[model samples]
Target: MNDTDNEITTDESESTDSEAIAALTVRVVGPAGEPIEGAIVRGEGDGVEFGGETDADGTYVEEEADTSTYTIEVDHGEYEAATVEYTHDDDGEVTVELASPVAVAELSVRVVDSAGEPIAGASVDAEGRPHDAGIPLEFSGETDSEGVYRDTVYENAYAITVDHEEYHPETVEYGHDGDGGPTVSLEPIEGGVPGASRITVAVVDESGSPIEGAEVIGRGTPHEADIPLQFRGETNSNGRHPDVVYHNDYRIQADHPDYTGEIVRHTHDGPADVAVELESGPERIPVAITAIHPDTGGAIEGAAVRLVRTSGPDSVTADAETGSDGAALLEVEAGEYNVLVADDIDLTLVETEYTVAVGDDPVQTSFEAVTEPDDCVLTVEVVDGETGSPIEGARVQADVRAENIDDMGLAAGEADGNGIAEIQGWCGEWEPAIGSEGYWPADPGRLDVAGNDALTVELEPRE
Candidate 1:
C-alpha cells in the first residue's frame, strides 16, 4: 500500500478457512498519515458492488467478496477522495492516502514566569499588523491551569503580549514562523520603581468654607535659572486636588466663579502645607460717559471708547459705542481706570489715557476728540429754500462712511447766524446732506468728496 511504508500484516480475524469469498479490509489515511475516521468508502467492480464507511480506526471490511479487481474509493470532508484497485483473492489489506487541499497557519502560546513554572490567570494576545489602516486582525486567549493559549490565524506579522497583575509584562513578535508555536516568558517584579508623590492642596473661601470645582494651578518655582512652572488641575467634590510634583518650592493658585482668586508660595521639603483665603470680588457700578468734539464742542457719535481698570481685585475692561446722542454706558468697578478712545476715520482723537474714579452716580463725564492734521473738514449750511436766507439755530447733520474701518461717524451741529455748520477730518466716502429741525435734504445727490480738501453742502426748509 502506498500509504503504509511497512508491509500490510493480516490479522487472524480476517482469515477464512472454508472455500468461500473472503473479506477485504480497506483503511484510509490522511495527507499527514493520520487515520481519517468516519470517511465514506465504496468498492465497485464488474458484477461486484459494496459500499461502507471507515470506522474509528479508519478501516472498513467487506465480507463474502469475490476474488476480483475492485475499485476502492475513500472520501473525507477534510481531504480529497482517493481511489485504488485491489485484487481480493484471499483476505486482503489496503490503505489509501488522500491529499490535502489548502494549508493554513496556526499559532499556540505558552506563558510562564522566570522560574519556568506555568502561571495561571495570565492574558495572552495575538494581533495581526495589516499593510494599511484597514482594521487589524486580533485574537485573544487566556491561559488555563497548564498556562497554554492557542488560536488559528492567517499568514501575517503578529504581535504578542503576556500580562499578569503581579508580573512584569512580556511583549514580543510571535508570527511568520513555519508552523511552530512560540512561547513567552514573563518575569515577576519584586517591587516597582519608586514614583513621585503628590502635592495635596485644599482651596477655601473667606468664610472658611470649601469651594468645590475650583480651578487649581501648581507651578514649580524658586529655580536658580529662568525656567517657568507649568501645571494645571481642578478640585474635586472636597475642594482638594493632589498633583505629582517634585519636592521644591512651588506657587499654588486657586480660583472659582463669583469669588476672587488667590496666589500663595510655599516650600516643599517633605509634605507641603499650602492654604489660601481669597477676599471678596469688587462691587461694580454702572456709569455712562459722553464723547464731545474738541473743536466743535458737540457730541461726536460712533466714537470707540473703552474703560480699563487701573488697580482692583482683577483688571477689567468695558467697551461702549456712542449712540446718535453721543452717549455710552460703562459698567465700572469701584476702582480707578483710564478711559481710552481710538482714532478712526470719523474723528482723529488721540489715544487719551484720561483717568477717572468710578463712584456711585459718578455722573456723566465727557471726552473731547483731539483732531489730527489729515482730518476731513465737512461743512453743512441750513437755510430756507424760498427766502434763500440763513437758517440760524437749525440742527445740521453729516454722516461719513470709510472703508477698512469698523465704525462710521456722524457729526451733528446747529447752523450759525450765517447758516454755516462745520466738521473736520472724516476719511473716505461720505453722504454730506444738510438736515435741520424742520428742513429736508431737498437736494439731489450728496457732494462727491472723494479727494476734496473742503466739502460744503446746503439745506432747504420743507414746505
Candidate 2:
C-alpha cells in the first residue's frame, strides 16, 4: 500500500506541472496590416518565461508557456515598442500592431513684459498627447537670453505653463505645427519692487467741472534694461484715475469727446499727483478772409484784418494782412468774434465791423472796398392832413441813386414826438415814403438831397 501511494503522489505532481505550462503564440504586424519579421516578443509572469522572435509570417509560437496572466512586450528596430497586459489560457493567441517611429517637431515659446520686451530665465513646462491615440509628448526648460524656450516634440497640441519670480504665472494652450511658435506675455506684479510708487490723475474742464469717461494713458520712460512701462485706464465718476508706477518720469494724456485733448508730463520721485485741464469746446481752427473790390468785384490785396474774441475766454488778438491773392488766414479759438478790416486805400464799406461765430471748421468770408461817397442829411416832417396835427411814430424810408456810386436804399428813422425824421448818408436823388400808425400812407415824390435839407409831408387820418 505504501509503495502504491508514493507512485500516485509522484504522478499527481507531474500532472500539475504539465498543466502549469502552456503553448503561447504571438503575431506581429505593421501598421498597414502587413506581417512584421524579426520582431522580438517577450512574456513574463505567472511562472511563464518565454522569449522569441517573429518569423517571416509575423508569427512567434511558444509551445511551452504557463497558462496564466502575463505582461507582453514587443520591440522592433524600425518601430516603437508596444506593451500590453494579456492573459494566456490554453494555447492563447495575441496580435500586436507596431507603428513606425514618428519624427519630432520643433516648438518654441517666448515671454514678454507689458512693453513687449522679452523676459529671460522663466520656467516653462509643455506636455500633450495626440488628439487621437498615439505616444505622449513632453518638454521642460527655461528661457534663454532672448526670452526664447525651444524644444523638439511630437506634432501635437500641448498646454504650456510659465512662471517667474517677479511676475505672475500664466498658462496657455499651444499647437505644434510647421509654422512659427507661439508667444506668451506675462504681467508684472504690482508693488513687487522695493521703491515702487503710485500716481493719481485728475481731469477737469475749463470751468473746473469734472470730466468723466475720459481715457487716461500713462507711458513711462524706458529704463536701462529698455523694458517699457505703460498703463491705460478710464476716469471714474469723480474724474479721478489712479495707477501704480516706478520712480521715473511719465507722460499722461487725457481725452474726451466733449473737451479738447490735453497732455501733461510728470516726474515720479514719490507719491505724486497730476492735474490735466481740458478746454470745453471744439479745437482752434484757421479762419480765411478775402478782401474784394466793391466796384469791380475783384480781390483786393494789402488789407489788414483783426479778430477779437467777444464771447469766449480772453485770448490774444489775432492779426493778419492780406497777401497778393487777397487771402489772409488767422488762428482763432471757437467763439463769437468781432472782425475788423482796414486798408491804406479808401475803405467805404457800408459796415466796417462784422460779427461771426467761429467753430471747428475753416471759415471763409469776403470784405469789399469801394470809393467813399459824399455824405448828405435830409429832414422830413409828417402831420395829419385832415386835422392839421403832428403825427407821431411814423416810419420814413429813402431810396437814393447817384452816378459813380452804388445805389443805396434803406429805412431812415421813425418820427419823433415833434413829427420829424432825419436821414443821413444820402448823396443823390431822394425818394421819400412816409407812413404813421393808424393813418394813410404819404409819398413826397422825389427830391434832390444834394441841394435840399428839409421837406414836409402829410398823412391823412383813417376814417
Candidate 3:
C-alpha cells in the first residue's frame, strides 16, 4: 500500500510541474488597432519568472512553466499600465489593450502660517522631475479655508510654490509615483508684506458725514512694491488725515476694522478728498486723452495736455504726457474741460483750440492747425523696363509755361536716378512728359498740381 501511494503522489507532482511550464504569447494593440512595439511584458507565477519585450509587430512569447495564474504587466510611455490574469496553457495567446496614462498628477496641498493656522486662497504650484522631463505639464489650485488645495499632476518630479498676502512666497520639491493621496505642506512666510502701496485719501459716511477712525489701505500694484503699507492711518473724527505716500495708481480700501473693507480707485490728480457715504460703497470713473500732429498728419509723442473743469472755484485739472503713440490719459470728474496741448514745432498756437467733456468714462479729441495755401511742387521718376534700371539724364518736361521752358518747347530737365525734379514756384494747372531712346513720346498732360506741398508721379512703361 505504501508503494502505491508514493506512485500516485509522483504522478500528481509531475502534472503540476507540466501545468506550470506552459508558455504564453502576448500581443499589444493601441487604441487605434495599431501594433505598439518596445512594450515590456512581465509575468510571474509560483516562484517562477518569465518576461520578454514586444517585437516590431508588438508580439512577445515567454517560455516558462509557472502556470498558477500568471499576472502580465505592460508599460508604454504616456500610456496607463495594462494587467491581465490567466492560467497558462500550451500555445495560449493574450492581447493587451493599453489606455493612455493620465498626464496630470492628482495631488492635495495645504498651506499654513507659522502659527499652524490654515491660510485660505493661497496659490499652490507643483513642479518636479516629470515636470522637468520636457513633457507638457501645468499645475494650478487655490487653498481652501482649511488651507488645503487639490490638484492633478502628470507622473514626474516638481517644485511647488505658495503665496498669500502679508506673507513671503514658499516653495518646495516633490516626487510622485503616479498614485494619488499625497498631501503637500507649505510654510507661510511671516511678517513680510506680500504687496502694499499708499495714496492720500479722504473719506465721509453715508449721510455726507465725515467718519473718523476709518482705516485706509491701498491695493493692487502699489501693494506689490518694495515699501508696502499695511496700514496708513485712521481717519480723524472729521474724516481727514495727513499721510505721505508713494506715487502709483492704486485701488483705495477703507475699513473701520468693525465693518467690511470698501474698495475704490483714485485716478484723479492731486490730493483726494472725496466724500464716501456708508450706504453707497465706491464709484469708478474711466480716464483717457488723445494727441495729434497736424504737420505730418501723424500723432505727436511726449506732448503734455491738461483738462481744466469749468465749474465754480472748485475746479479740478488732470494732466498727462503724450506716449509714443501720441496719446495721453487723465482721470477726472464728469464735467467740461478747457483742453490745452503744449505747442510744438508742428503745432501752431492756434492748434491748441481743443476741448473735451470728461464724462464718467474716457474722452478723445484731436488737434490740428490750419495753414495758408502755398505753391505745390511735382516730382516725377522714370525707370527702364528692360534692364530694370533708372533712365538717368533723360529729359522730363511739363506743358505748363514757366519763365524758363527748355529748348524742346517743353519745360524739360535731365532725370536723376533719384528721379527728383522740382517744379518750383509752380501754381495752377500743368502737364508732364519724358524723353528716352526706344520709348514712346511721354505725355506731359498726366501731371496735376492742386494745392501746396509735394506731389509724387511714377511714369508707366511705354510699349
Candidate with top lDDT is 2
Residue 233 Cα positional deviation in candidate 3, in Å, after optimal superposition: 14
Model 2 lDDT, residue 284, Cα: 71
Q: Is candidate 1 or candidate 2 better by TM-score?
A: 1
Task: Write candidate 1's Cα lDDT for 149-255 as tens digits.
Answer: 86554456778888876677888886554565677898776553223356778887788777788888887754432233556877788777777665567777889
lDDT of 1 at 388: 76
Score candidate 1 by lDDT.
Answer: 0.69
The number of clashing residue pairs in model 1 is 3
What TM-score, to 2 decimals, does candidate 2 have?
0.29
Clashes (N, CA, C under 3 Å) per candidate: 3, 1, 29
Clashes by residue pair, model 2: 22-65
Give the alpha-carbon lDDT of every model.
0.69, 0.78, 0.62
| Candidate 3 lDDT, 363-382, residue by residue in tens | 56675422222355666666
Instruction: Give TM per candidate.
Output: 0.31, 0.29, 0.28
Candidate ranking under lDDT, highest first, comes to 2, 1, 3
